[model samples]
Target: MENYSKAVNLLTDADVIIVLAGNKMAKLEGLDLLGKGQFEQDFPKFAQKYDVHSIGDAFDQQISSWSEKWLFWSQLIEQYTNHYQPSEAMMNLLKIIGKKKYFVATSIFGHFFEQAGFNENRIFSVFGDWTLMRCSSGINHGTKDDRQVVQAFLAASKKGQNLADLVPQCSVCGQPMELNLPLNDHFYPDTDANTRFRWFLTGNEEENLVFLELGVDETSPQLFEPVIRLVQQFEPWHLIAADYPQADFPLDIQSKSAGLDADTATLIEQLDKNRDF
Candidate 1:
């Protein structure tokens, strides 16, 4: 109760809030990449052929052809993105951050934040979003929205038609296009959004900023250490981690940080209940 009060106070008094969300947050939002939840039932072909039972394992397998790969990818994307519904925790988070100056830096590539009504400009998807596609010609030919392409493939697939020609090609180099994910060596980060996130940090250096760590774990080391260092550097900055314990943080920022040692849903629900406005 005391910890919840402190978290509420920090959020209420904060001039800006920075959310760092990761894989566990993705799981809470109904996108469990590593779990074996109906993967074989939904995607029997891929499961039998590749001997894979999870999305993460499926991604690691090299499919036989580009068309087959796109077909599989389309099914996954359509199910996750086109059919996605924001979870209760996401709604509570929105209420907790009501009208506050905020930004989201997430490693989840499913575009959950954007779909949940968060400002697109304020989000920096650290690992890139899967809904966009880039040239696979080992060159940065820019990204294009592949949602339409995904829809086309799904439509074709439903009719049992060949998905060979439906595979999207890069307009710039006429090369094959791939999902904007760091699957291999050719993945390019979103530099424009990265610049915006950096500027937001610079602008809020002196403000009473709160770093809300939501389900960040070992998978995304990039989001963890650097944020802690930033909190240590900025005297007015505070950290509220949903998963980490207070004792785990450095002694310097211990006074300003609150590690709730709970799941993201619980923390967000508490914040929503405790928030005065």
Candidate 2:
């Protein structure tokens, strides 16, 4: 109760909000990549062939052909991103940050925030969205939308037809296109969005900023420590995390920060009911 109230006060008082999201937020939105809940049931062949019981394992498995890889990726993307629905937490997030200056930095590649009506320009996907594709030429040619190819693959699955001919090719080098995820060292993040996120932080340095952490765990160390360092450096910046305990926060910012030690969904639900927003 104490931490929740502290979080509410921090959120209400802030003029700007910076969301640091991780895999737990993805699970809340129905994209549990590392879970075994539906992976084996949904993809039995990959499970049996490669002993891969999770989407994370499947992604790491080196499928024999590009066609098979695209097929697997398309099905996953279709089930997650194409047919995604916003969760209660996502709705309450909008209410909490309503009409306020906000930016989202997420490790989830499912495009959940953008689908939930958050401004795409203000989002930086550190891991990259799977809805797009990049050239496989081992060079940074650029990214292209894979949604159209995904639709074709889905349609082919229904008719039991081979759509290998429809595999996307790079317009620049005529090589096969791969998912834009950071599966290899050649992955290139969206520079424009990165620049926008940096600019947002620079502009809000003097504002009352709430560094909101959602579902962040050990998997995304980059989003975790740097945010805590930022809160420590800026007097007006407060930290609100759904996972950590209040005792874990630095002494200097403890009064201004709150660690609810709760999941994203539960925290957002409480915040939604307590405040009119």
Candidate 3:
């Protein structure tokens, strides 16, 4: 009985459902979270000598933003798309979140979301797109000028090596380039991401938030705590948290701990049997 019937019932009652995404979602979307296989494939020379077991995680934990991660991965894609053919895998991941209203933190998946059909408004990307670039200068604070730099960066990335050698530079002010999230103390949230943050705070005004976190793990507390708070405040009848190797939840609800890297489609297929809507 714990199937689509109950899952859909929960969905119908939901007002402002949100998904605080994590790296698993990215991995599902063709980006390697551990920098294991493809990272090796992308740069076999480096992988051959050094252990990249934690390099990707370290970058996110250290010098890079979420967008920066994808941009880096895209560099990998540029290098190996013909040999790797990651498009289908990314496409599959995108299809899953395509219909859901969500907030993303600038993984490559964010771009795939757009490719998969999520509306611009429904998806609030907390980090500026890695697919996008702008000068890291504080001077271009708010202007049409920054977008021009962004466009130029995009255009240059088209030529291929630009992705390999692209260094960030301010258009007008000649500053270093920056990614869109708070990767460090020096990290600054961009204007759009700031606007999205404000919008996300108010996005739940309808106040019907159900978090359908498919693969969220414990790298960041920021994503997890708020949903728990929402669950407590509204007491949303039930919070259905399904994960592969699922984790614990509150006493009020039961979770479907499938296993790590569980087939999300199978879970959804089972959940949708009676979801008819």
Most lDDT-accurate candidate: 1
- The order of the candidates by TM-score, greatest first, is 1, 2, 3
Candidate 3 structure quality by residue, lDDT tens digits, 116-234: 54566656554444444444555444322233344444466566544434455556776656544445444444556557756875756556555665556665455555666556555
Positional deviation of residue 64's Cα in model 3 after best superposition, in angstroms: 16
lDDT of each: 0.92, 0.90, 0.49
The C-alpha stretches of model 2 lying farther than 4 A from their native spots are none
* Candidate 3 colliding pairs: 4-271, 16-208, 244-259, 244-260, 245-259, 245-260
lDDT for model 1: 0.92
* Local accuracy of candidate 2 as per-residue lDDT tens digits, 122-223: 899999999889999989999988999998888887898886787899999999999999998879989988999999999999999998899988888898
lDDT score of residue 148 within candidate 3: 39
Q: What is the alpha-carbon RMSD of candidate 3 to the true structure?
A: 6.2
| Candidate that beats the other on lDDT, 2 or 3, i.e. the better one | 2
Error of 3 at 5 (Å): 4.4
